[model samples]
Target: MADFTTFLHFPISRCGIHVHESCYGGLPVADPEETRWFCEPCQYGLIEPPHCEFCPSRFGAFKRADISGRWAHAVCSLYTHGVTWSQEHTTTGVSWENLENSVFGRRVCTACSDKIEARFGVASRCESGMCKEYMHVTCAQKLGLLVDETDESDDVIVAVPRYFFCKKHTNQENLKTFQRRFEQWEKAEGRRITVHRRKKALSGAEDALRIQMRETLEETIREEDRGKSNGSVAGGEKIKQARLLNSSTEFFDRFETKAEDSGLSKKEFRDPFYDIKLTNASHVPIGFSKEYIE
Candidate 1:
């Protein structure tokens, strides 16, 4: 089974992976194994590819303007603000050669491609789904995926949400409220995030054991809290706690595979080879009955 790091060597020798915001940070590689190759960076969803600087995205198409002058992505330049480069000169003008190499063969930027889409609309996509015409990087940014680089090499991109109002449509007053909600998610789900990190760093059955232990610990804590609050303890719970405290190798037959995506074969899910995705937080609905909460 090919892993996330696997790349292809066929009709499409994709040099690098292209990731859009809606599709998470970006696909690590263009392989069929990761059918759902998406990142779940908690706050940020998917990242998108950067547009060619020569495109009409924001500054308007300045094609053939002077491949003479060295160019750089807007985001990269931002970091090197105030640095000056001359035109026609190699190192003198273009401080960022990596970006210059991107347009070497003269590729069009997302801006011009978008115009073509406008004149003869093309398909564009983001979290909200697909778009009819080609939108500038700015338009895509407005939609959510804020591309920092306007270079060529950068293929994969991350999608950033617009103003935090897309999902909940929160007003200024609600911003802090939403922040608190996310903070709570982080606090309660910190271990989950760690689990995700470990999954990426480690693989195979060892990773599976880590996840199982995390879940088991979380469950134990919840149960302990519940018992303390209710002033009552179940007889079995004592045995469970004792087992948990005994050792970390308490498999207790909690092994075997778990199917992540549907239609995938019955391969045992010993542990995921890639990073774990956290689509939504583990939170109770706002308006649950008191009895339900209890």
Candidate 2:
């Protein structure tokens, strides 16, 4: 008989695949056939005949599809889910929580329909007030176009904004000037307060982002440096490591000392009381030699 296991942990499976007694406050696992589920989405029954929106696959009980009613390939769905796969490369992991609010309508590249939601390549956007097109960062640079720069100093490759443009829509000359000035401003403001880094030469509406970037860069650099220092070898870390090693050595030495003082070889060190007979309180030993007691 088909069981609830048919849906567990499968993509598009609405139910948890593997469960534990600790999952629900130490609740016991109920029989899958006997347990009654009330949630409309939880019941492992086909609500409607399945038709994949992305491909010509026919859906069944075992085949998982998204619960959102859109059954595209996992790759296609990832693009609509927003936050590019490239982000997982620069950052730690990928999450689908932001998919519902994704600005990208689909996972296909805005320039080319190739899948951009996978971890295989990089992607970017235009930061102009308008235009939400997607393109590869290298693609932008290859055409001598400017991509967004970060206020983040430690972010090896600065990430482009979510809403970026391609070279076709942006002016190269203006963008080049902006990039040059941005670099200059960053070097001058290396690790100082934003107010102290403010440049009179950049006092204009267009340069407003430059001022804001200074503040953001300052904060980001400060935070990263603070975190690094806290986790680095300079912050008493070596002392702590030495202390831990010393403590472990002391512990092992004490164990060895106890073993040596016990006066029993490894083969002779069996539990002596494991099979002893005990009839009453009087059966217990009342006295022992001082050497044996010690």
Highest TM-score scorer: 2
Candidate 1 lDDT over 190-236, as tens digits, reads 44434444443344543444344334433443444454447454431
Which candidate ranks first by lDDT, i.e. highest?
2
Quote the positional error of residue 282 for candidate 1 in Å.
47
User: Positional deviation of 247 in candidate 2, in angstroms?
Assistant: 55
The 10-residue segment of model 1 with minimum total lDDT is 241-250
- On a 0 to 100 scale, what is the lDDT of residue 128 in model 2? 58
Residue pairs with colliding backbones in model 2 are 12-65, 79-107, 125-164, 126-163, 126-164, 126-165
Cα displacement (Å) at residue 144, model 2: 4.2
lDDT of each: 0.26, 0.30
TM-score of 1: 0.19
Model 2 misplaced stretches (Cα beyond 4 Å): 1-90, 101-110, 113-125, 132-138, 141-146, 151-163, 173-294
